[model samples]
Target: MMRIVVTGANGFIGRKLVRALLDQPSLSGADGAPVPLSDLRLFDVVPPEVPAGAADGPVTVRCMAGDLSDPAALGAVMNGGVDVVFHLAAVVSAQAEEDFGLGMRVNFDATRALLDACRQSAPDGAARLVFTSSVAVFGGDLPEVVRDDTAPVPQSSYGVQKAMGELLVQDYARRGFVDGRTVRLPTIVVRPGPPNKAASTFASSIIREPLNGEDAVCPVPAETGLFVSSPRRIVANLIQAATLPAARFGRDRTVMLPGLSVTVAEMIKALRAEAGDGAVARIRFQDDPRVRAIVASWPARFETARATALGFQADASFAEVIRAFVEDEMGAPHKDPVS
Candidate 1:
């Protein structure tokens, strides 16, 4: 039986990931045998809505809500030994940029504290830790297409925090403190629900709001492109990173997940294809230099040979991604699964 812990479990991706984990009968161990889940603890600042009847199932599901910055709160959540941990708590791009202090406390300080807790709790360093990093880690002067070997020159507070987190994960893995892996995720598009503080939130808002019969504002130019993954694919890749053998990551623990490079114009076109021009008409462009500057700094292309070879995948196209959000989140309608 395996005990797992998921931080930031209340988040959109975290909620979906937890449900996906519960759906799994068992996780594969290094020996290739099924490791039955005995207990699952979800930690966040807010209590996550657990899937109905999850506690009644074979796996014991527990939700702990409190600031991870508090050692006592974090310790209580990890009271029992944890076989696997997913660290997803963080401050988003725009928010982090706005409140550097808050970002430092949650994104940097809390992460370090969590790493220390994991180190102390699992002295043998057998814990499988999955840390979700971001493409924001790369900024300043970037190449046309970021590759496996590209060096991160972060330009924003959020990017700096994530870059620091990646280094911590790599160092912990090297010191045999934990079997850690980092997934450098792209801008996740079509995230369900209302907009967030992320500078990239508009990317989702433009599609999500209109599909819900509401108006949405796009702050960046139509020509601006982004390297993005859908929420579904991001969750899948995160799970894949956790299941793979530690040796598979080798010396570099950071895996840049695959994503689609779609311009704003192309994304809106996909929305039109699905909801017609009427839905497209609901979107308005309102340029903001601040948002544009921050978003534009992020690299919009990638060569993810490493993540691809490791069996990670991305969404096929923006149209399919929009359809997925409509079906899964909005309940608009279900389309055939894209290959």
Candidate 2:
């Protein structure tokens, strides 16, 4: 029986991950039989709308809302004997860049505090912690294709915080305080919500807004490219990261998950292919240099050999990405967005 804790459990990826975990028969234990989850604690700053029948399964679902920086809040979820921790909480890119202090408190301080809680609660050092890192951790004169060995040189505050968090995770794992694995994710495309402060929000906005019958703005040039993954793949990879044996991670635990390298023009082309030319027309290009510059600093190509070898997977194409969004979010008989 696994006692699981997911911080940021209300966010886009977090909510989806919680749903997946609840539906699964097991967490893929080594004994051939599945490891049934006994308890699932979903912690977020705001109370997440609990999914229908979330608590009706064999698992006990606990919804918690509190500040990540608050000790009492961390204590509520980390009472003791937490088998796995999916640390998904963080201040996102542009939001962190806009408010440095808030980013530090949530991304850095809160993360460190969570690690401490895990250390104290699981004195036996048996907890498996999977931290959702970002590609932003790599910046400033990156190679054409970043690899597992590529060093992190973050430019933005959000990137810096993630880089720092990665280091802390490595050190904690080294000291045997926690078994930590950091999966550095690319920009998640077709996120199922309205635009937020993330410079990359336009990536999702271009497809999601138009599909939802709204006009959308593109802040970067048509040729601007980014490394991206779908929400479905990310959620699956997050669970895979947690379920794998601790020894499989070896000495270094950071993994750059596989993603599609897509330019804005290419993405629009895929959107057009999926939803028609009218959907393409709904996007108006109005470049924001600040957003452009921030996004431009991130590397768009990677040879994720290590992640692939570890049995992780990537989306087949951008078309699949868009289709997945439509089917999952739109409740589709699959209507064309232009219609």
Q: Pick the candidate with the highest TM-score.
A: 1
In model 2, residue pairs whose N, Cα or C atoms come closer than 3 Å (at least 3 residues apart or on different chains), thus clashing, are none
Residue lDDT tens for model 1, 59-139: 999989988889889889879888889999888777898899999999999988888888888899988889999887887
- Candidate 2 lDDT by residue in tens digits, 1-339: 889999999888998999888877468654435688988898998887767787577888888999989998888998746988999998888789889999999999998998888888877767888998888888888899999999888888988998888888899988999888899998899898889876788999999998987899999999998899999889889988987777777888888999999999999999999899889999999989999987788799999998998878888899988988988798976443421
In order, the Cα lDDT scores of the candidates are 0.89, 0.87
RMSD of each: 1.8, 3.2
User: Quick one: RMSD of model 2?
Assistant: 3.2
Off by over 4 Å in 1: 332-339
TM-score of each: 0.94, 0.93
